[model samples]
Target: MGTDKRTIAVRFFGGAGNYANVLERCFTYVLTDNPDEAALFEWVKSNTRATSDDGIRDRLRFLEAIGLLTVDEDRVALTERGIEWMADTEPKLLFDALAENVRGFETALEALLDEPKTDAELGAAIADEHPETGWSDPSGPAQHRGWLQSLGYVERSDGTNSLTDSGRDLARRLASDGPALERGKSYTQQELEAAFGTSFGSYIKGISPRTDDDGALSYVIVKAREDGPYGDDLEGDRFTYIGEGVPSKGDQSPTGANTALLEQAEGSTVPVYFFYQPADSSELRYEGLVAVVDARYVFDDDHNRMVYQFTMERLELDHPAEFETIAASVTDGGAASIETADGEESEPALTDDETEFTETQRRVRSGAFASRVKSAYNARCAICGTSRESPAGTVDIEAAHIYPKRDDGRDIVQNGLALCRLHHWAFDAGWLAVSDDYRILVADRPDLEGYEEFSRLEGEELTLPTTDERRPHATFLAAHRGLHGFEPAAER
Candidate 1:
């Protein structure tokens, strides 16, 4: 049989010198001043009576032990608790930190509620109440009494000590309600539904985007796999998501769940919650709120099709500590009962068909179309005949779609043009268009900064392919010209 050892909740060191006020002062200084290790040590030495270097270090360690500060090798900074204490410098804040972190802090204080007791009496009570701490030393009890006295929770009357008015109230509250810091509890999918009144049955795959009752997008839940078809990149706090589609099929389109995610782009009212499962654990971790900063379509390889890639940034929330329940809901099971801004559980409208990847094989056909267009132009820009070759012997050319894929453009060689980076940008920006007679139609903006360069190529005939079947189609050229507000350069 294996033996189990009781773990100590918190370590309470005696001779920490100063009280809560001194700790708060130090915390405020560190937060506002942003001091380094030397600066903090010097300040603590000068401000407080801890003159020796070891004494200053001990004070800093005590602050860290109480969860007020985090002392790194090079820097010393305030923790979340320390920052909160600065905002609300109440005795209860200090009391909360003490009660949670320090062993027998409440036990000693509660013992003095009815009558006054000396340090020895409080020590006896703490030892009896919390024998796991094994605090046989007298310093442990003296330290607790000193901290309570400094916090004004307990006052010494002659030889004995008793709880103050505020101390008695806090002790009673601790006994009845316990500490304010509520630990997170992990629950299954059924339990989350019981708590928040929502169903997550539909969003079991890659991207699960849902709408509210009013037909407006509510929230999006993205399930990222570590070894999935689409590789999701996590750099720092930003997660770059590849739009929905499998590799065996075609490229990903901005439709279904992909469109739902795009709808919540930057300024949209919809909230997006990211959940990912690590390789080691079976649980899915809820990575708080994320806002989609960017979304664009790009083609990376000849084997793959153009896909919409979105960059999402994790937003800093006001009350991050309150995310314990949400975290548990996502991690325990692959479901989350999200709370809206108004603190109400939103019943997001989700259907099985809405999130299905019903995209056609257009991407598969589009990749072949791009290859034919580039090969027709001999891997050179048709406008300027600029054939840029990389050091790796790969030609730099993009197969530009005359009618964009977003507008249901057919992925045929007749609707594509092979252009270099500069002309591709100009064509996409509506600064250039194609005519029916294979001539370049510039936007004719002479007043623009880079208009002269483009205007020179206005009447230049586009480089045509030897095969008539691979040539730019007149219908697609007319669509491009009409879309860019350009008249035909030549008559039939």
Candidate 2:
């Protein structure tokens, strides 16, 4: 073995799909149970589905490859990093171990940031970048993608794979210790503080979008939850984030986080990092380095109070050409609106032309196309027969384009499937597809972590509509299969 380059090999482990939790349990067992080599094998066989002692040894070798464990002829023990992981058991500790010890781990993740890549393309990029790994064919890319998938770093969609928000954050963090610049990635509070080299002061009471002592804007954090009391809207990939202030309170003053963001709209040079925490989770996702395109105070009927709202553009993502033209108009002269303390309105930020532009670009999808597909499938997921209906009589079923609208696929019923959110995302991501014979076809990469459930759905018949005309067209299905690389049963 080369002393510098980490060797690439195929090592199978029974409970590796969710390796972090699985390894944490295994480490705890080793520490408390105090099992010797033979006793450990017996414990693994009893506790997990590991059927043989050889398979358990393979798992040990896999751990050893990542520098988490050491296995001798008669003894096994955790390394210093492994012991640290055992103490904390955070997923980042394990991920850090992989990046430091395993060659190409960071590179493999960074490759997915640009766009989705096929497994072969992803592997080839890693092998090409770090030639010292000597990785060729089956071993190089497959194991890397699988490990990333297991760790919830990469997600497959629309016939190609890309990094998940968490994975994107990890890739960015590893690439540079400097300020985070990537949009749509996520970071913990601690991670953000480390990246910025400053404390946020306080998340509970202090104003978000914290300002430095010199009054330079640090970053903006939004609790942008859909179900939250405050309203936040997204259009053309731009977010209209609610400014700081409680809804139950009287009219909000343009102060604290709100003022920090307003200064950007008023022509500040500093780039603002936009972070959002969902209603369900504490993880603050980085929206991007944002520019405040528009900001204003508006009356909220629901909360019966006046609040400041900032319309932000994620600098990295594309926007409509017309919006760019309108933005130039706003930047040239139009002043952002604000309500004075005496309850008077100021000059509106958006001109009449800009308002008309926003209205025109508000919705791009056809409601009729969505309705027809859902009605055809009885508003249920074609794969799982799942349907989500709120008490307000609205269903959560989504209409998926079989051949994809971006490729000029039509909005007709034959090219659509009414699916639940999970199936819709899965189908779009190439994790699952439907065969010509109306059977479900899952991606065959079982080496990927957390693939067991999806793998089990392979070859399961799809739930089709009653009439032939309403069914998914064969041409469209074939196109989807070709896009996702799903071969027919005979080919397998």
Candidate 3:
């Protein structure tokens, strides 16, 4: 019987540094040229400076240990999956192979179908499945869950876990489809180790840290419109980054590269940095380290096909300079000045003096405030009282500012309300306004195209936040009402 998976893994990755390459090379050699096991064993011993076959056999055994090889007598062969492994360049596939060796993965996956389960509960089932091993330990389920999540097969909210769309798809595929590993080949690199049988190994590189084919870190840059995508409470921190078009033109979801990344990003931290291109700039600004949180499938109207959307979470970096860099990048352009102002640089351009806020501050505040308001409101669009999931696969609510930040509006939840696109645009255009009493106020536009819809909304009470402290600030609502010549209601 093969050794314990944990032990095999520990030894496989652990031995002499140079020897680690042997198995991968050996696998590659087999794929490139079918060779006998005796010949491969001699090849390993010759290079390893060993007189006996024991060391090479142990190495071969370890490979067999991970379900990567099959050895019968003097013949060595890579399983169908092993053949695909040579050219396949994805780490998730590596994880999938590794996960198969983990004892309780099957049981845990099945139990998750009926109801959500906690990591510990899943751990118990794992323990039951692998009674001879320590698969019942907490880490067992957590590790399995991490793989499931990383594979986009599951979603964990709070403490409970449930199957995601990808997870469900995988289950059905497993039931109806043939074995997945036997498909195709990776063709990464090929050459014999100049050995006797060649079955022992080849000289190609094994898995490296997740990176582009050229070894550079990968990144996703998104575009945010000034008043639209980016604002004081939303669209900067964790937004869907894509354009609706063909692969080269900005349609990211349909692009094959991004879809694979979205899968790897789930459950796993980012393998590359993330950046954002502001509405007007030609250069990209570093956002921060991010994790691909989830994927949503939606029809791309422009592409006229269903596309994948990747959602990401921004992680705090260690240094303050990172944020400073982002701030400077956003405010990159300079202006002519007649004279320097007191306690300020000599630039003549109006600072926050006119807009009452700088673009830099607005960007910094938008991401945080947006997350807060959405969390506070449970990600519901306040105006329509309905769920709005965007085609980008994110919560489709906009954290509309009760008072325009341009007018020195506060970036607080009380100064924000989550609105869908229609209401947000209407409010911004002064076509619809909210009263100080949290009531909807549509301007009596006699000739507007959608006059009847506005008429229907004339007295609809706004969806208020759960706590009074977080409710729309009465003063801010009054200011918004004041902008459109509507009377402010009496104070509470």
Instruction: Give the better candidate number (1 or 3) by TM-score.
Output: 3
Cα miss at 89, model 1 (Å)? 0.9
TM-score of 3: 0.35
**TM-score for candidate 2:** 0.38
On lDDT, the stronger of 1 and 3 is: 1
User: Would you list the C-alpha lDDT of every candidate in the order shown?
Assistant: 0.65, 0.65, 0.55
lDDT of 2 at 258: 73
Task: For residues 362-391, write the lDDT of model 3, one tens digit per residue.
Answer: 554455466566656777778787765555
Report clashes for each candidate as comma-separated counts: 0, 4, 10
Q: Distance (Å) between predicted and true CA of 105, model 3?
A: 49
lDDT of 3 at 152: 58
Q: Which stretches of candidate 2 lie over 4 Å from their true place?
A: 1-3, 9-12, 51-55, 72-75, 157-160, 176-492
Q: What 10-residue stretch in candidate 2 is worst by lDDT?
A: 326-335
lDDT of 2 by residue, 92-130 (tens): 777776666667777888888677898788888887887
lDDT of 1 by residue, 410-485 (tens): 5556677899989999998899988778888888788888898888887799997887767776667777788887
